[model samples]
Target chain A: MSSQSVVFKPEISKPLLQEVMDRSGQNVLACYQCRRCAAGCPVGDETGVTPDRLIRMILLGEKNEAFNNLLVWKCVACYTCGTRCPNNIQTARINEILKQMSKEAHIEPLNPKVAAFHNAFLTSASHFGRVNELEFMSLYEIQNTRSELKRGGGWRAIVDKIKDRAKLGISMMKKKRLHFKLDKIKGLSEIKRLYAKAREKSVDR
Target chain B: MEIAYYPGCSLHASSELYDIQSRMVFRRMGVELKEIEDWNCCGATSAGKTDDFLAIALPARNLGIADASGLAEIVIPCSSCYSRMIVSQKKLADDPGLKNTINAELIKKAEGKIKISSILEVLVSKANSGEIAEKSIKNLEGIKPACYYGCLLTRFPCDVEIPDSVENPQGMEIVCKIIGAQPIDWSYKTDCCGASAVINDTDTSLLLMSRILHDAVARGANCFVTTCPMCQLNMDAYQEQVGEKYGIQKRLPVYFITELLGIAMGFSPNEMQLDRHFIDPFGLLTELKLI
Candidate 1:
């Protein structure tokens, strides 16, 4: 372990700790830095900020650094970290709050593709009141293509990606899993209203 | 025994095989699965991550419908859907403010009375009670399966409250034993399959799935079984891709737990939609003379 000392500044630590506690309903102070969460985390190797490190960062008042980590975006919400936490800290739930806050604060996500996919899913749900897998996949691909083009992957990368998706699509079709028709639940208007209410609440927050 | 059924999006579409097999297995065992009418999406992890209220509200709507239908318990076949619905119900019950807001918005009160259960939970209980054992028409002694729970089915012990250990659940193992199949002991049972990231981050999902598949095969599992359509989809459909990426010729057939149970309960391979699997299980079934 590096012997770098963290300066405990109450000025920064107090409010950040309170905000996290309020939003997550988890006490950062309860975490004794046990690293149990990290040990059980399935994507610990793939994440920029491991679960233990994230807790430490939050406790240390490294608010921006903790919130902006790619791990928050990449977390599959598998609850492995939460389940393994000896302190019952619910690290996965905390990560979820951090992700929501990150979105609200407009922190540039390290993984835009995942964010895009989420937006596509929400859009599909808002429209149909249920997820149309084919529609969601198409919307996700379109958003992914735009992101790839913006990242300068150019036309060839986009073409290759579409080709791959097309192959998968065909395979799913062959299995009769991919339906061409759009599916909507009966209470579309009720779902739309709920979305509107959620948006209002989100804006209020 | 009649139980409210919530098929969610995947069961209605991509994982229709799971729905068919589960219904068939339950019907054979004298259980009536009444599909919840007009149930909406459970919002899953995607919506849950985007907005907490929407996530809860989406499933809350389904709970309200189930509650109105007078079903005390709702059996969800998909693990992801079960997790969302259960978590949402708990959240709604715990927070009256959130529940009131959702109730006001949806024009339905989410009373949180309906207990959400995974199909595995329901089936395992039946197995433990000897209902399934008595119903098994064929022995599965030839098949060795690694029962993969993935994440959602038994994650977060406080929330899910599954019958077995959350970290190393044996609900499926119990079911396998009841049906006469040997369930292999293996790690990575509760490991994440990277879920929706399968679409957004294919490489990461492939790597994760490869690890799970490799672990199962290393433990001498001839086939893999799961309850979640998302997990089944990733392991079954993308097994080839992961094998190609890792340069391993691991071709373990993935089956929904219900499919295996249905087979043992005298349902034919065609009824179980075994051919619908991307990695067709028929060859393995033939090899084991299970067909």
Candidate 2:
């Protein structure tokens, strides 16, 4: 790794760091440039931003760099870096906060599929009080197709993907790994209420 | 002999083999798994990544239901579910004020403590007591498994520790030993499989999975077994893709820890749907004379 000299902007650091800390409850300021987290992160190499670097960006108030990075979207949330950190600074939690901030700021996600998958998971969970795998996958595929079409992706390619995935889905069903039933938990309204409260809290933030 | 069961969505859907084997093994041991009525998803990594309340409240609802039903303990077979449940529980234990605020916001009550156990933890616990050994009927001597703990089972959220060693866990191996299967030591046991990415960003998932599968093969493991549905999905279903993407040709069958335990309890492979995996495990079992 190479080091670069850059101006530290404390003026820009306050709001981002303050909100991130308040949101995640992680001590981002406690990071001492110990690259232990960097050494352990599985995607740091490919993403070009490690956990330590992400924390440093917040500490230095590089809002642009921190918000618009691949690591934020690509992080597996494996808790490996958190497990290795001496200060217990979990980058996964920090990434989650940045995701909320980015979405609020209207920054288009660098990875749409991951974003769509998370959205599908939440939507399925909120509706059914649990994830209906059949419903979730369908929702995810619709978003995926919409994004593909938006990117000027080929209809032929999209159809080909659908055909391939359909084969796999059918095979899994045959093996009894999948079901064709629509199901929900008994306390459905309670789950819906929780979702409503969470949405209101996020809007307030 | 009776306890709560939280068969998370993956268990109820994609990883039915794990769910079925868990029930079969536990039933043979005389431990009844009563699923908490109307249990909800714990939101896995998705909820926490977007909404803090969804992450906390979802798992808390199930924990609250278990407590209300007078069940003090629950078994979660999925590693992701276990992590979410235990992480939420730890938060309540660590901060009473925050717990009170969360409890008040929950439409359902979440005021009581609940113990969560991974199926690996349950299997190892039973193995430690020689119960698994006593129930064994098959001669499964030569079957060797690379005991993959994946990311969450051993290395839980920090400060929330399970009894197994974090860096190098032996809980699965402990169960394997009693059932006459050989469990191999391998690197990457606790490494991330880039699990969720296997859905959205498959190239990265393939790379991470190949690393784990290759390491297990190099370390002389004939097969792989884990309790995590997410990990099993990557390790088993994607073995062909992993091989094609990484130039690793070895195809090792992966099973849930409960599958091996069930076979030792004299359950047929067909009964456990062991052949349903992309990399069918029956060939390895047959070669080892385990069938």
Candidate 3:
């Protein structure tokens, strides 16, 4: 997932902080490390740090820590913490922000599998404009397996993946029932233009 | 209007209960759905991950058939399918070159025409609150349900924000309240359950689901409701797995919003496909005196 490295040294400006707070709410600055956001976050226990802590780190301009921490990667983007934050913080959105920052900074991915999946997700959207889960999962597994092999332990797992291919194929084949024609949508051209614009923006950023 | 319905792969397999309950719920709600004569796959997450053209083509092919068969909209019960179809539809509607490529592929697969829509949007629009109000047999009281949107339902339509608040939506809550249930304030309404990955990746799914269950229990919620079959399957079937792994034994029955509505309307467990659920929704109904 890392095409480049992003280095941050807590040089956050006031306007950026205000913009996040405005989109989310002003109470985000009121978080006092109570960890309520983490306590209630659905993915918090699975993550290294709580959602509240992640947000605090960001608010305090701990840009490097916020972007590089594994906590930022573990978020499922479920929006649980965002809905429950007493500080009215959009923890999920903040997580999205961190993810984007990580992408920009090219931080080492905590879970290369997820990063592969994320890349696959974007690539699929950019190309076809919709995700085909079966293809996506297969590609995700392949990419993840390749990443694992690069780290020197994925070869054994490859056999298991191959052994399970039949079952996987069965599951993948199940996707055939809900197909639809794409030519009839009233807004096809605009959507493609927007997608191209987005891809360019992300690449530029 | 009779429209072709694609229940997706999951509805026929992993979470057939959603398919069953949705059929019953839709029937009661007075909406007619006819299955497509010969439908193909939508090429779900895997397709989307690997090949963009395949992903769009998968869902697009299905819509083409529905359209050719003379149905403007194909109502889908599975959240993944709904999201895929909507995203694909929007993409096709927005991109001419992609639409041409997708349409050409679809014509070879099917001889029909169709549009795509999620059951959630169908409930909100096609079979509206007016119809629901007219056919009301029971109203939920003292049962504060938190309408869980999961992720697929609201992520698209990036403009106009069709459902409710992007973060915490109340559309399902409003639907429940309209049918007479008091929607509660819960923290994990939009949280993911580590869904389809739970099969391949256990630890993460367990950890995530445990946190969600813990949050709901802490909020004093008696039950959980959702639109996605994967979310329902993971949340319900994996509850045991999660508890076993974490040593935290907490069980909150998860129901398809349709099943809850079925019961509220005095429908039996059989009618709502309660017997098919990993957790017996009937047990919760009995506890709530809803059955």
- Chain A accuracy of model 2 expressed as TM-score: 0.92
Which candidate, 1 or 2, has the higher DockQ?
1
Per-residue lDDT tens digits for candidate 1, residues B31-107, read 99999888888888887777877878899898888888898888998887888888888888888988888898675
The Cα error of candidate 2 at residue A199, in Å, is 0.5
- lDDT tens digits, residue span A1-205, model 3: 6696544444563445664555333355677776766776655655667877776666666656766665666666544565556656657656555555565567766666666776665554434444445555567777877778888886777888666655545533342322233312333353354445435545764
For model 2 chain A, the run of ten residues with the poorest summed lDDT = A174-183
lDDT of 3 at B212: 77
Tell me how far the alpha carbon of residue B60 in candidate 3 is from the true structure, in angstroms, after superposition: 1.0
The candidate with the higher DockQ, 1 or 3, is 1
lDDT of 2 at B168: 85
Which candidate has the highest DockQ of all?
Answer: 1
Off by over 4 Å in 3: A1-205, B108-115, B126-128, B157-161, B244-248
> Arrange candidates by TM-score, highest first: which order?
1, 2, 3
lDDT of 3 at A154: 61
TM-score of chain B of 3: 0.89
Off by over 4 Å in 2: A1-4, B95-98, B105-108
TM, chain A, every candidate: 0.92, 0.92, 0.72
Per-residue lDDT over B109-156 for candidate 3, one digit per residue giving the tens place of the 0 to 100 score: 332345566777777663354876666677677666556777667653
**lDDT comparing candidate 3 with the true structure:** 0.63
